[model samples]
Target: MEQSTAASRPWLLLLCLAVAATGGVLQARAQLDSKGFISVDCGLPGKASYVDGGTKLSYVSDAGFIDDTAGANQNISGQYIRPQLSRRYHDVRSFPDGTRNCYTLRSLVSGRKYLVRAAFLYGDYDGLGRLPVFDLHLGVNYWQTVNVSTPGFEVTAEAIVVVPDDFVQVCLVNTGAGTPFISALELRPLKMKFYPQVNLMQGLVLDVRLNLGPADLTDIVRYPEDPHDRVWIPWADPKEWMEISTTKQVDSEYDDFEVPTAVMQTAVTPLNASMKLEITWDPVPQPHDLSPGYFIIMHFSELQLLPSNALREFDININGVRLSEAIRLVYLGVGVIFNEKPYQDGNYNISIKATANSTLPPILNALELFSIMSMTNFGTDSRDVSAMTTIKTKYHVEKNWMGDPCAPKTMAWEKLMCSYDTGIPPRIRSVNLSSSGLNGDISPSFADLKALQHLDLSNNNLTGTILDTLSQLPLLKILDLSGNQLSGSIPSGILKRIQDGSLNLRYDNNSNLCTNANSCRPAKMKSKLPIYVGAPIVIIVVIVSVALTLFCLLRRKTPGLMKNSVKPQNETRNDGDTSLGLETRRFTYNEIERITNNLQQVLGKGGFGYVYDGFLEDGTQVAVKIRSESSNQGDKEFLAEVQILTRIHHKNLVSLIGFCKDGVHMALVYEFMSEGTLQDHIEETEMQDA
Candidate 1:
């Protein structure tokens, strides 16, 4: 476990601008909206068509252009991502496995300068507790290697690429450094002049796009309100800054894209804005004394409409250098944007103070910071991907089979092998199922793997006639089917293939199985199976006859005896034909009494009755819910509960084992919920609060 240090690690390539040769920052002011902008929320399956609240750019799920197979390793699900700037990052597709997973961005105009950005937020999503570093690629060309040293921050990689083809692909290649995953992917069409001064070949990296304001505020400014959905988040320290809003209309001196109007509406100033405002910007913490270059963009607007005579002036000082001598504030509606010279990481603090001539204190509406990176691999094959998916589903194999199966070569699924030679799509070369306790017939999908070489299914209860298709695999060299219940004549074609020395076969320990083509026989079953099944039923029938005879005699002496007799077994099954395959047993009154010791040892009580702790004959603890004698909805609730419990099953859920009903006396047994009642915890909290 090594911690990344400043000396050994790459300088977090923080982006866009640095102080020019003359010590002034480069200010990129505009962009003309074009027709070809594609936004993709990676790993999303459905067509999620919506607009981003931050950028106001409309994006759809990646399914329209790319199929499921192309997204071989999309794994992130059910994680609460932060910022929530846009819905795009909620469910990510990860690459816990696979050497490379590529997303092909189609319908792109060839020869256009496309601005592509890929975002990643680890959020410790995999719970591995370690961040991953991997390469990001554009088709066959190398883009940028995304190194996420910190968790919970959305790392974005951007580049200006000239698309040579109609469609450009973004690929993520795992370099055996860490498990790579992607949150959001964006492909926007850009006009030639989007980045005027920067070299097109050297890509710009996005470090931080912050909207410094109150931490408690979840308000993110995006499109419709601003026309361009540039997301602005609030990050002001509540104790230091005061949220101030102006009723006056704010106007964009330039385009709204230069300084978003939504952010300009509200501003954060020092708590005592009536006095001289002083702000010390907090510098991002670094691993060592080394300085990583960064870009900062500050947004400001005159919140108050001041008289022309009362001039509001301030100086921008960064690390002790003034941007200019004296700056005059525009009227209430007009906004101001400042792109500061890049600074090195240190005890650096950005301060903005009002001059003596200023009528009002300084106010900052929003600010953003970024780190730059340079430009990035292949996607996994389609056929092998489909075949592997079928095998897992058919066998119901529950393993960490997330992400692409082979790309990040080191993370291939357990008990599986893939071909890793170079440019060609990887194929499933081998599958090992030995000692995995497999049963039922072999999945026919296994035969679809054209490149399969070795197939092992030893030490299992698998049965069924061998499919001749097994011999159809042209590359199969090793076939092991030993220690299984597979019985039947081996296919003649397979037998010939085995005899001709083309197949290395193993078929031992299956006594009923016939190896030779001429001596085929049907599988024979154990001779004692019928006797073992019929003996118990015969004993139960004789006992039932004697009990019935005694019940009839007792009915003559007591008229109510026949009414108390247990309803016929068929009566329980006649509940409108909706058993739904629930594994419930019909317990008799005597059996319930034996298990619950006449309803002793009450665990708890509900509206129904006393819940008595009991155990099955196998010593499995259960809770016997005996209905209260005064309960009104006993029969209805019992039937309703039975119908529901039979359909639902979960680890946290208490399993309904069986039920007993003798006239009005109803009882239900459930697997114990050892965690105790939720109400108990609530009551304990109440007591502590009191």
Candidate 2:
């Protein structure tokens, strides 16, 4: 989840090595290395630049993050910086990317004697690139930053850090925290020599007791009767509290400390919303470990024990083009998602350039996004992403499933996917009508869709048998009939027929589906011997008997035995024969069917129908083309191939050997050629010459 290059890998690895070598608990201290380091001083025009106010940032991924405002006026004291990532802005000042946001900090001073510390409010748990931050409770990993200040200061006990004069990208990361919040940040001159050097500790310990509304919060409270009435103090005794720097402390008397709290709740008020846990600690006067620690005994309310998970969707957007269903987002700590889409609409430079004052390396994180027409929730159910895409492409439904559809382009209504069918007029490919409380049977007109692939009618008040007409589709892939009041036998016939025809059937939770023994009741029959045995035998017998009878009749009616017999094998035959013609075909349905073997091993399906991979007796590979009854152009293509191949003779054109003319079953059989079609060659070029 978190990636660090050898050069850009966090100093944590070096810190780990240091701890290992030290044996004892290595004290958090500041080290000064005069080695080559690039440092830029802010406010010197060319040296330090500012991201002017009103500059736009576009988040092009599910971890949507963007720069919403111009850089805060050089805040030397770190107070009241406008919210960039989490704070909502109207029109001109919207948060560009989703949470997991990042902002650039510039280095102001580029010299010794002055240690610069910078901090910002991090949301969605990671720093600029969605990287994790340190924990505030249970110890020392709460704040992360580099420090060149001298040792002897217990400054590493806070949630902020100080570093040298280098351009760095600081990301707020907390693997344990579900969401992130920051109230204030500070940057000041560090008096490193004044603090006493101590061994590095991973946790921060506070010792102050808070006056509660007649309750004890010394231990972890599970289901507390009144969480609102119960106030908590991290330290046990109030006397243990000392006057430390204001920037480092997390929580103090609200009257005293300038910290952000959840929308406040009165004492004894019903806890309707999930309470946000807030932890604040001292600041790091120097660089220290800022990994997430653990939570000690804390106070919480009892109304009920509620464990819930949040959902997050991740997408990728390369360059300016948006891909569809590209990224998978997962939560490391809560095991759920926090932010959804990362990219927002606008122009971006497509680079990771920092714009603030700090001493951290530039992070190489970019955004990617996928385009979805529409998405909807039917019930308390999670649908497969693939299944959802199929349904949308099937019903000719329309929606901008990914919220906003076009960027800097004309817009359509929400929940619509339109494809350019001809010269730009849109053809709807998907529709999501789940849980809209609609009542009716699915319109039979849906089967008219030749390009439809996905259809979802779950959790609705629809009633009807699975349409037999649907089986005629050559592209239909996913069908959801769950949570409906439809009564009928499972459409096992249709299922078995289309199992290999891009059809995925989902009919569970529909109680009316019958699996008993009866033709009227659709039996859930798996595709195997039984259905194959019955259907193929009848067709095979009829085709073979008809072929033999026709052959016998033709032989008797011919003028001579030699004339009725097969032609002598000749490699030196002329292109044109008076009776047979130059290009001719004489093949039986039985032969074509036998060669295709019940239409197995399909190469691909197009607007016509399935194309099967086959080989002649001579061991040359070929394509067996079949026309689907549902294809509007099926007959047209068959006739076109016959007419064109008869005249066209080139190395590129297929050499037609024969064709079949079964009733309503038109096919073309050509000399076996290993080379595939031009389209196939372009799509997969690595294959053997075709």
Model 1 stretches with alpha carbons more than 4 Å out? 1-35, 46-59, 63-90, 96-98, 108-115, 119-131, 137-169, 189-199, 212-216, 272-292, 333-347, 375-690
Model number with the top lDDT: 1
What are the per-model numbers of colliding residue pairs?
31, 88
Q: Scored by CA lDDT, what does every candidate get? A: 0.60, 0.33
TM-scores, all models, native as reference: 0.43, 0.20
Residue 487 miss distance in model 2 (angstroms): 12
Give per-residue lDDT, candidate 1, residue 659: 78
